[model samples]
Target: MKGQGKRSICVSLVALTFASALAACSSNSSSGTQNGTAGTAAGTTADASKEHRTLTVEVFDRGKPGQPDLNNNFWTKYINDNFGKQFNATVNFVSVPRAQEVDKLNVLMASGQAPDISFTYTQGVVYNYVQQGGLAELDSVLKQYGPTLTKYLGDDVLKYGKFNGKQFSIPGKRTVLAGSNTFIRKDWLDKLGLPVPTTPEQFYDTMVAFKEKNPGNVSGVIPYGFSLQPSNPGLNYIPEAFKPSSLTEEQFATLQPQSIWLTNWNMPGFDKAVQYMNKMYNAGLISPNFATDKDGKLLDADISNGKVGAFQTNWDGPYRTAPGTYANLAKNVPGAQLIPIDPWQNDAGKHPKNVYSPNGMYIIIPKTSKNVDLAIQYLNWMADPKVTLFLQNGQEGVDYNMVNDVPKQTGTTNSGDKMMTVANNLDYDILSNGIELGDQQKNTAAISAGYPGYEKDVENALKVGMVDSYTTYYYSLPNAADAKSNTELKNLSAQMLAKLIVAKPAEVDSLYKTLVQQYMSQGGQAVQDEYIKNYKAQNGK
Candidate 1:
């Protein structure tokens, strides 16, 4: 908290002047009370408020089947502790697994048992909730109590939470990176007397060198591999060298004249990328069953077997593989270390074309809440830097310790592990921005020690990050008919890329042209027109 107060004061003075704003109001309560007889449901109540009320919240829980803690974990307890004190209303934790979260909440919405706050994902769900008239527009409420959020979440992102100009949900911001950085076995690189790659050609050479020199050791290793599932694409691990398909390019094209990039995924670079992979595949440099295996099994088998020489992977790596998964690997292969190979190392700042996904997750406010203002008050508190830090780092000595002027966690707690505990114990959630503002170092130290460094690296990487040219709102349209079409186009493009990569080199252009035609036919042109019009309208073009 060294320069915290100063930073806040400077920020406020130049901007909202939070102190004056708060001082303009009386020390009147920001609390919510239960219904004893009738209710002071909205934010109009004066001081001298008292009652026992509970606000139900719906959330995703990471727990085994039939576990009570899944729904009401330790983290939920901690969150309620703070909210209950501030609001005088209990915050209830409603749990559902990831797969069932939206579906279950939909059911709850239909039954009128929907919690006061629910986190969701797709724009479809958020828009659906809004269309149902089941959400509150927090314009007034946020104006009164959300200065911190107003500052941090910014305007456009906040507007993204709106439906037809009215804010219906809170923006659940989530951090994004182009693709998981490619990690190579550095030890092998040293043994082969080769420098780290700094271009696509160099990277291919390095992989080829490793395969040639190491022989059987790297025979089954994948030089360039990733989870290629239709559902997700393990989006975070896409190579920056593939920068042609970036969101920035898309946005630029919306305004200026530029060739359609991602639409035509069969470009020379893509074909070349595939050709490199083909070499890996035929030379036995990649895992034999890569295409057939699911994401988890593919990673688990490759990393554990010490056969993955280089791969597109998240910095956190595969530490969370199920029980006995990583442990089994440790027993079988001791020297199989995962070394971070910055994609820049391979392509040397040559980013591959890709788009930024939206920067947030989903948030829903139930229509049943007694005091929407009170709820907003508490959530605004979540936007407070102090509170964000606490939620991320935990309460001082209890969750972490300060060392060398850095906040670090202590004991058997890690960020992800602690997140599970904290979510259940404290009723907390994740946000996209402010990863560094919170005691992030402390949180990461306990778990992967790699977290802090990775955070910084990713932050640095964003300087060149391409914001998606398309608005997530396009994905939230009335029937989401536009999004469905884009999805089809994207899928067709990916399939063509895959086929081109796996096919004979000569067949690349023909297949790419076919995919491009498929894109135009699948409402790609409509999507482009809509995206261009909307983008200009939003940006005042």
Candidate 2:
């Protein structure tokens, strides 16, 4: 299976001039009918004028247990009114659970019920579909119908969509590229006369002090709050400090998980990290129910109730914004102060974090779709700057007001919750050219409007330069072993890590070794071998 050779083939192409190609193509005409013939163009116009084609789009549904309908909300009607009427197309959105996107799309594709446009963050899912010929080749389709999208995404970014010399999908561009960082309660530190930690030992000591002193209303305070859930595990970045630099070419290629390459539990420093976590658990410094708080609700509540002293979260959400952990905590516990800090120093004594890929989601057309051109047209329309603004901020006067040329959201509801009511348009905003990238002054003003006087905190948090995780290259090639074994390996790793953190101090080392060996034997070795082979071939090493 090592020399199956499916992974060895590479595609290299000179940048095709999009403007000339687009200028030559007939306007609003689908792929094959681009030539201006009276019969073809007239016939297409007549058909479109009489009856509009139906386009089904897959969007992420993130409603709570008993909230309003996520799919059929105000944004659905907005899309129908604005896009459908303009394009002579009827728009329908299919809701896929955000957490179970891969599983649900697999079922839909298998049953020939997949939408015209489907998207995923996982590279393997798209690879699997392309390998099975389940995706539509978008190069010709895009050239004929997607001038706006081509112009917006450009040639360099679109290269990410190419596989085996064909464009199988459109790669969404990411506006930001920094991993999550640790945040601590500055008020607590001040109350206890403690300074912010800069090293691993200092961080450990701080947690111990927080546990012992109980700075703010000491009773029931958790020094460190974390969750072991697969999706958003707590303290996920702690082990990076212990990561070993010396690695073989193969080891480096397969070192970290897909979309994450800066650090890994399989590396040398993981044992020490786990042991430190175990020590915290034993000393009651970490939350007691961390192993079972899979969805992070408990931790969220703890942070809000002023029970958590420190936690790790994405740069923007938890620290610098409102309707978030910091905002909620401030409302519940007066004078709560949260500050972002890059305190994890690796073996090299430097703060290193994973660099986010510029690619956000892989948007694809299904082979079974009847209206591929219409789908491409819809995406192109969305890539328009005005449309992107409207989708992101809603009606200017109603949902937001322009301040310093930035659309700052208005009303009592904060930006985070307001997004849900607006059909979470950001998810369906396939182009991802939101206000975050458009205007710096407006972006800062909008963030400040959300969480008054915290714009500087958000700005400071973005100052840390991130290191590349190399996920772009990893996602380009197919890894057969990963398709077969990555899920199991991740599950095993999460479970074992939890066990290692809560086990007896003496049992920690043995537990780590046993789990690592088990992980390798179960399928990690095969996955690593395939990645190593692909990396060497791609890099000509």
- Alpha-carbon error at 393 in model 2, in Å? 2.5
Task: Judging by lDDT against the true structure, name the best candidate.
Answer: 2
lDDT of 1 by residue, 126-210 (tens): 6666765667777877887667666667775676687777878777554332323456666677777778775666777777776
Per residue, candidate 2 scores C-alpha lDDT tens digits across 274-358 of 7878988999988899878876778888988899999776656575433367778989889989887767787676776755656
The local distance difference test score of each candidate is 0.50, 0.67
* Position 368, candidate 2: lDDT: 73
TM-score of 2: 0.76
Give TM per candidate: 0.71, 0.76
